[model samples]
Target: MPNPWDLPDELPTDLPVSRCELPDGRVLSAVQEAEAHTLWEEISSAAPYRKAAEGLRPGEAVIDVGAHIGLASLLFGGLAPESRVLAFEPAPKAYTCLEDNLARLLPGATAFRQALGAASGTSELTYRPYVASASTLYDDAEDDARNLEAHLDNIGADERTREVVRRTFNVSQRVTVEVTTLASVMAEHDVDRVGLLKIDVERGELDVLDGIDPACWPRIRRVLLEVHDIDGRLGRVVSRLSGLGFHATVSQWGVYVGGSVHLVLAERD
Candidate 1:
């Protein structure tokens, strides 16, 4: 059998291409090589987000927060062709790539070049070009460096391993991004209910969740979020979601090492 991760021979060279075709046979576009690799990992996962998206119904609404390059949005559109998807990505380069991918694969979905935060305003996003997904509103550069050093010391990590981590987390650029609340955006779009809500913002997961009006919480049927627990917000986020009357589960599956990140999936009881 052919290697599933191999780049397709027939892939269009004129545009940035997805490393692999999605489950529904739609291709994604990647602005960088790192983004393409990440997309392939998600496509190959057996239990991504604990299958939270499995609950989405046709013609329902889906929100893809931190929709870097629009892979998830494309996947959702393919899975639920009738569903209206709103994809939010703030990074300019990634947003441009997202726009291209969505237009090419799922023309009906809306892609927004804005970040979701606790309120409507603007904020700085610390971007790491080496690892685009590591870009975040929380500037954890010092903390990350210190933590990595400590871990290396504990394990007596080789020079190669230490160097890899250092380069992977290096900052490349800082950009100001427009921010809005989930509740506000939904209202502006006249979207009253959502069948699936997926959040993968590096460390702004809670801020995005907090931005959703409490009254509108009931209208969200399911949530899959990547929570950066290294900052110690996991407990608070889980508690907040539980208080909203949802059955919540947190796991390290599908996340990077260090036990600092986790996937939180919640659905109404």
Candidate 2:
């Protein structure tokens, strides 16, 4: 079967604002050309994540950690409209797009313009233009770029090689952003139980998971994370979830020089 994510190739041109309805009826608004591909991938190849949100009951909650521009949040809302969605994203520019998209796509949902980390405080984020999705809280922007280049070189796929050279090889900037913990946010919102907790905080997956209070572990029914083991956190994450009685299912998505990418789905026994 042809991957749905393989859409028609389009020239990268800065669009002030572009709006499109996802196959599921949720709206995605991209503020820059850099965000276009991210939106496409989210809408097109989102079967697994969508499956994770299924079986949700009305009034249940879904938490989107590192919800860059609200892709997963919107997806969750569309998949389970009766369920509430709360999204957390720290990048200012992306937050704006997130807020706008959520308000139009799922008005009942919430958006938090703060990064979720191991503690509630503030941290600096390396903002990369033309590739905002690669922004990370772990400060591995340069290392990530180098690894991506190395992988593209080794893959030897002409189309992917050209895409990488055109996209990931871009400019970056740094800025400080507010940070908070999942436990704290849950308490602030008076949330009792979470049906699904999806995390994609670049290389800071473990930090985000660490912020969850141990006491609240049972409150979370499922956890889906895009894990980057740059600091050797993959094993720790799997072990932690396993200790919490979550049967972990891991899918190795891609490989790079310094580290590999994985998607981990952990559900309570």
Candidate 3:
């Protein structure tokens, strides 16, 4: 399986390699290397994602609800070679690139070109994507005006601009998509034991969580998400899960502003 002709025969003593002269007529580098495919090596170590990568083991089922180009999935795959992952990315361009990258990086990983939410039926989805925040779910009304509290709840805003934007502008959409809830889809596949679940569905987080039942929260071991502020508080999201006994702690490592990326790690007692 190894081609000896491409390596040096002498292999230096001070170097970090051992050379083995083949019986027939070849030299092996004796340097072992593990193949990898990652966009940036350092980013994979930046978040709680780094800890997730370390805890990963072969065959653990993980779900990437908003897999953008499979960056996290690929990194998880590299850390746990034999694990099976399910990736869902809604944006057309991102999903396409996600599949393409997975094909070359994590060939065994499964990819879904659908958005995840609390419902199964088709609902309008605005593609904000990861790179842009303004490209969020558009209001049907071009001149739709939302109060600052409403905007902060849907998007994120402090007391600073609550009434300002409501008095000023509008939002529009160039596209819309159908979304499915995780429970419905996973139920169809009979996945009861979700080892890890990461939700970064831009602004559709509330919709996604709405689909999950309080009873099922115990089954979900981890939920790394970008939660939106419904009003001026994270209570609505927190209260819902808290009633179910999930110790929801909010943190400030961001991919989404106004609200923090909520890493609500829960375990069944």
Candidate 4:
């Protein structure tokens, strides 16, 4: 299947592909990068159906952590439209682009421009907007860019760029949106059943999962995650989930930051 993400040239040879709504289905395609928007399609979370399918079924509660320019949400919406999707994004500039993309593709989707961490209070997702390729919130942008070092340097990555600290990726766009554990979110929303829960929170995955309770673990049937470039976070996640009684695995898929993300599955018990 074609990647649902609209790539740099996904717009085709047609010059300046602005917004166009098809007559029959009303698929409004908008081109953001063409107008020098400076955003890149994160292969990490954009497409890859298996990543989205892992531990996923109908009417599931799928949480998208660090959902930048939401292609995963679009996939979940398509796969499980009836499911409740909490798409979290934390970059102001990128979140703006995310809104534009979601409005055009997933109007029914709920957008949370905040970061989801283990402790849940707050943490910085150190980044270099100049290195848009490595903007996955909590992960080290430098390391994630190692693979794209050459290509990105030609386009972006400037040593002279200014640096700043932020609690949310979108500090200016902060909304103090309710922060809750995956368990808390489900209970509040009256989620009797959770089909799939996906997290791509950079290095924050370790902390996020660690924050959950043993009871909450079993409630989730499947878990797809983009593990950080840490020593044992990936293994810890699989072990923890498996211990809670669900089959899990690290899947093979191209990602912008970090290596291939892990696709851990935990079947309902």
Task: Name the best candidate (by lDDT).
Answer: 2
Residue pairs of candidate 4 with colliding backbone atoms = 55-222, 90-169, 90-170, 92-170, 118-207, 118-208, 125-137, 246-266, 247-265
lDDT (Cα atoms) of all candidates against the true structure: 0.76, 0.77, 0.55, 0.54
Residue 84 lDDT in model 4? 73
Model 4 spans with C-alpha error above 4 angstroms = 1-48, 54-58, 130-133, 136-142, 145-180, 254-269
Task: Give the TM-score comparing model 4 with the true structure, all chains together.
Answer: 0.64
- What are the per-residue Cα lDDT tens digits for candidate 2 across 1-269? 54333533443433255665655555577655445654566544655686688788888789998887787887688779998899988877778888998898789999988999889888988776556667777876565766676566655658755564555345566789999999998899988889999998888888888899988888899899988765567888999999999999887534343446677888887
> How does model 1 fare in lDDT?
0.76
lDDT of 4 by residue, 67-109 (tens): 6656567667766767777677775554665577677777666
TM-score per candidate, in order?
A: 0.82, 0.83, 0.62, 0.64
- Cα lDDT tens digits, model 1, 65-147, are 99888777766676678888999999887788788888888878889999998999999988665556667887776655655
lDDT of 3 at 253: 35
Error of 4 at 216 (Å): 1.7
Q: Which tens-of-lDDT digit does each residue in 1-269 have in candidate 3? A: 44233333333222233333333333322221110121233336455665555565456667887776666777677776776788987656556666776776577888887878776766555543223122244232322222223435654565445443332223222455557878776677666666667776645667778888665666576665655444533567666666666666565434233333344443323
Rank ordering of all candidates by TM-score, starting from the highest: 2, 1, 4, 3
